[model samples]
Target: MTLLVGVDIGNSTTEACLAECGPDGPRYLGGALTSTSGVKGTADNVPGVVKVVQEALSAAGRDQHELAAVLVNEATPVISGLAMETITETVITESTMIGHNPDTPAGAGLGTGTTVAFAELGACAPGERVICVAGAGVDFEDAAAGIAAARDRGVEVTGAVVQADDANLIVNRLPTPIPVVDEVTLVEKVPLGMPAAVEVAEPGRTVRTLSNSYGIATLFDLDPDQTRLVAPVARALVGNRSAVVVRTPSGDVADRRIPAGTLTLIGEHARLPVGVDAGAEEIMATLRRVTPLADATGEAGTHVGGMLATVRDAMAETLSDTGGEQDAAIQDVLAVDTFVPQRVTGALAGEFALENAVALAAMVRTSRAPMEALAGQLRSALDVDVHVGGVEADMAVLGALTTPGTRRPLAVLDLGGGSTDAALATGDGEVHSVHLAGAGDLVTKLIDSELGLDNRDVAEDIKKNPLAKAESFFHVRMEDGTARFFDEPLPAEAFARVVVLGEGGMRPVPTRHPLEKVRRVRRSAKHKVFVVNALRALERVAPGGNLREIGFVVVLGGSALDFEIPDMIAEAVAAAGVVCGTGNVRGSEGPRNAVATGLVDEHAGRTR
Candidate 1:
């Protein structure tokens, strides 16, 4: 019997399958997986490949010297890079709005008056309507006393903006309740003597008057042009429980569309140019117009240009030693429409506005020289015969066919970390495949950026696990609205907080967003990446770009292991009359080890 090992080097991991070939066929012995040492399809992967192979051989109780050959898939180095360009920005020339959700504000009504400093409240003439501005140095008790004394003199204290967290204290001491907005970090920046309006909502409610443009217009008696400019301020104030809109002589808010630059799609048939500001849908539509993309370029000295250059440069640096004649070229691009929370240009408090952005994920493809170079390195390291195996997609399809209830004319979706690959196999032994950018990593990034988590690890955990709100020490409300009871008490930090139910136990989400909001963002990010890429890949592989032509689709790779990704894809493809589900390779390995197993099966066929 001859012992052989097949290795599949993926973007994020390296997998190996060990098998023995006998008179009848090859019997699978064992398999092993480890993180890829370096970027896929490069010589840096030698160390990881060696480690995985040794593990597989050791698990199968075979010595390295007994191995006949080590076969590796024909890996086309695919590197995916992401960039986000903010198309719309909200810029306030003057400090016109303080729209932040302070945990505790006072009163529940609208108050409008001329802004007056706390020290000047005593000098205000009787019946003069004014809003009190308390500095941090003033105590809440003293400020309340001063306001009460001014009111006793007939000075109308319509509202108050406090530098400290004393809104509740001040309002409780006042005989007549008035709206009070507190926690104004940059109180000094508030324009004095200007007309301002403060509105506070009751508990468990959001501010209404200040959140509407018409409401602000009526308060300030703004003209048509002035009202148009304040629309962005109103938008920024939405969902806040308390807000303060100060109208200065030169206060201006502008929602401007930035010139993010253009992208040139180089295809086999035509070259199309698309503006980054045109949004994601337009860019993707232009990409579809030019199928079989050869390369993509961006305008010089522009955001899109810098983004594309960065992706190209990264790939070139990794493939510098591969001795390839051509430089790295962008083979595919995936554009996603998303919102990024950007700090308002001019605001008293650190308020953020959700700005429209287009996130692009580009896939760089290098020649086979890199894989050949890697093969030589592997041969030297292992001192065993190393052969570059068949096309990766074909091998994956072959491995997927081993799954029960699978047969000819089957399609496979290899959803990995960096790219989404699709392969269609027919009875005549012909395989059609396409590789596209954007997969699990992109989804994680989207979740990270959209939710403003700024942490990939936390976003990944949220992507992989279900979320829950800790209702009590012993019970938690799950994302699906079901209650889960724990025998032991939960962590104190998780009480009344949104937590992720991962294998390592409950991890509290650091964001102040509620459980439902986080869950919505997570699911939306998944749907945008996996479900969209699945359909895009299938259409390119299916005959005449018709998904209906494909009968069965077997999902493979790391992303297939996600709890909700497979179901989302299945639901999406069902509309086209396609049966889709996660693949259980060999009826034992679930959605994994397909490419490695296929490499072994192909070798066994050739030897026979």
Candidate 2:
């Protein structure tokens, strides 16, 4: 019995497939997968590759000496990350605009009054209509009773701002109804003795008065110049259910802008300059026009320019160290249109506004020096004949062919962590492939920015799993609006939240967004990354650059295992009459162990 091991080094995982090869043919034995130790194609990946091989050998109940040969895939290395530079920002010069949502705000009308702290309400002389500010130390019950007492003493309490989540609690106890804005973490900082406007709309409605610039001007009797300056403040608060605007001294705060800088696309005799503010569509369109990109650069003394230069320099340095003859050059860049939620600088309440921005990932065409070095290292360590196999894309296509019901004139979408790769295998043994930046990691970055999770792991969890809302101790509402009951009560932390259903069970999501909102964001992110990339990739590899020419597609890689991604892409490309589904590599390995199995298959032919 001759045993052969095939190892595949992927961007996110390293897999090993063990098989028994004889005169009859090769039979699949077992497989094991582990997280890749480092960047693919690098020597740093040797340890992880070895561990997976050992695991496969153990699973198959075989010893090291029983292996006849070792085969490894020629892995392509890709570097990916998220970068942002806001070209133009809308800034509120004065401390104004509270655009956040509290679970339950109170009242229905807008109220304008002088700002006064809760403690000072008792000392009011008379008839001073005020918006009471309740800070951390003030109890909601006490604040409500104090407002009623002050109203009885002829001091009209028109509205209230609170630092805690007790807006409904306080409003239910009030004698005369008043607009209330709660969950203002900086309530103590509200400018006292200043004119302020508070607006709380009815349930299922957003504030109209505070969210409009003209309405704000009408209430404050502002001059034309002042109204124009406050326009951004109102625009920032457009979608809030409740809002507060307090007038502070002018010039207290100024908007900040990071020069987005110019992108210099160096092509054959054509150098075009594009701005980061031009948006992703324009940038990609410019790239499409200037094909065969020689090199791209950013303007000097700008955020994007510096970032591009740094990446290029790092790649060049790394390549030089690997004994490469040519300097590393950036071949392409992928840009995604996204927004980052930024907090207002001087606002008394915690307020955030979405800033239009773009995130980018660059791709570099590399040599085989790294993979060659890694193969040499593996050969010495494993004490066997180990060779770097065929081209990465060709191996992927061959492995994809092992899937049942797939044949020639086929397309394969390999959606890995760092890159999305596509290949087409023709009937004449011809293959074509293309690699693009921005894959799973890019989706995580979008979720992190849009939701303000500030944690990549948490964002990744939201991206990879389904969501459910813990409506009660024993009941949870699923994303599909169906309720489920649990025999035991849920943990306190999971109650009243949209939780992610991860491998560890129900974990609470740390955002105030409802289940539907978070679900929409998650699916939208996937659509933007996976579904869009699937079509884009298919177009590139299809005959005559037309998707309709491609007959079938097999998705492979870690992302292919995602519960919804495969189905989503399949449904999306169904219009093109393409049969798309996750690959069952070797008719048994599922979506994984494809490249590994292909490595052995390629080796068996050589032996014959």
Candidate 3:
């Protein structure tokens, strides 16, 4: 048997796990969790990690040499990617050119040739034949719903489709075969029928077909020429010089004209689409294959910001000169997320792929295809033999485990400052992780925002636990369900006063409720949002069909230490029918040490 150590270096805490791996697989020996020494993802990482490692070894009564090897992931000396997109104008003509995505703000439909109305589309004048237009009267969601309503009810709907940027996605929901033009400024000009079609430049040519009797017949079931002046409307529709024409409604299309109406293009909006998602699978894929976030932001971002072809050449050079043999493995593996930030803004004729950029940037685990390209580029940059597996923060400890959980799968959620990372590990080596934007720091931000307290440190305290006023005396109730009444009441001046006396310069609060109720509400409110979101994230990762299926879960990192946060979540999870407990990294500390312990576990491999 060989002894291995896993060191998990985190932003606020560090943990180490010791394990022995042999013929029977890996077995856990002892572990140590401690406060981290310094900021993570910096040159200071090694020292903090070393401290955790020593603690773990001391617990096991062993030395570092007893360890067989060491392994590290994107944690500790954290490495990643970043990219910025700024455009002068993201909106352009043709929102429905298969790229527009008008979400929610507008209803779904392909409407054309109607007079403009001052009122918004949702509230149209009865039979005014006027187009509804309202500023701030609707949102992208509103538009999408309206369009959808029109299409589902088979109404003649048309207009310049507006979306919250993802025009193509909105376009996808519209009635097929109906021309739902997106991105236009002049929606009113689109003529109604032949009487409206007269503006067409070419009355005799196909331009006239736009507002012609045939056009009306195509868009609506209107009898041929109810009004004789329709010649002009048709002329305006299919204008000479390569004009796009809405096909006339077919008599058999819907067994009748589909609430026939003209199709018009308006609003300058871009489309953004989120491709197939596989949660946070791409995080590992990225560290294994894409360029580091530092590299991208430091210098690589500049390179990719320019001509994409330049990025292509740079990728080739980096790969050929440095990637070596791991190229194939890195290139072949796929991550699970694909995101498109704000779609096409111009008349982009051909495909403008982000594959090469994503490969080079390799920051977050976004999507499958983009991640694959990132993998290829990553292989070319690194000389080390890298393998993509396990959670970034919790895996190190798990790797040292010798006995499988009596349960088939377990969830480990590591809450950090910048991001909240939760992973569900299947005994079979398959892991699903969810990396959300909010975590410890975000909690502070929320507290600050909620309390109207601009103080970061105060917000931090509120986030870690709950707060209550000292009331009549200088005493206050703690969130752990305890109260401390002071001997003397606080001076009114101390309300917002920063008293440097407390461990964290805490200030007194004035509340309408008793100290106990205030503490309870604060703690309860935080948990309601954070715990619920975390559980939902975990549920999405677990292969188990329901919350009850998850037999066990471990909570780690700074946020977990919230005097009542862990218990709050425990109760919440239990309510969902699962057995859950706060993490005991090495039998002492709770949520603070998973990262450091994980580091040791990662290097030591299957400790059990």
Number of the top candidate by lDDT? 1
- The candidate with the higher TM-score, 2 or 3, is 2
Question: What is candidate 1's lDDT per residue for 475-536, written digit by digit as tens?
Answer: 99998999999999998988999999998888999888888899999999899888989999
Candidate 3 lDDT over residue span 461-540, tens digit each:
55554454443346654545465666666667565332212445456542223445435435544553457546655765
Candidates 1 and 2, the one with greater lDDT: 1
lDDT for each candidate structure:
0.90, 0.82, 0.42
Error of 3 at 457 (Å): 0.7
TM-score of 1: 0.96
RMSD to true structure for each model, in Å? 1.7, 3.0, 19.3
Cα displacement (Å) at residue 72, model 1: 1.2
What local lDDT does model 2 show for residue 277?
75
TM per candidate comes to 0.96, 0.91, 0.43
Among the numbered candidates, top TM-score falls to 1
Candidates 1 and 2: which is better by TM-score?
1
lDDT of 1 at 517: 92
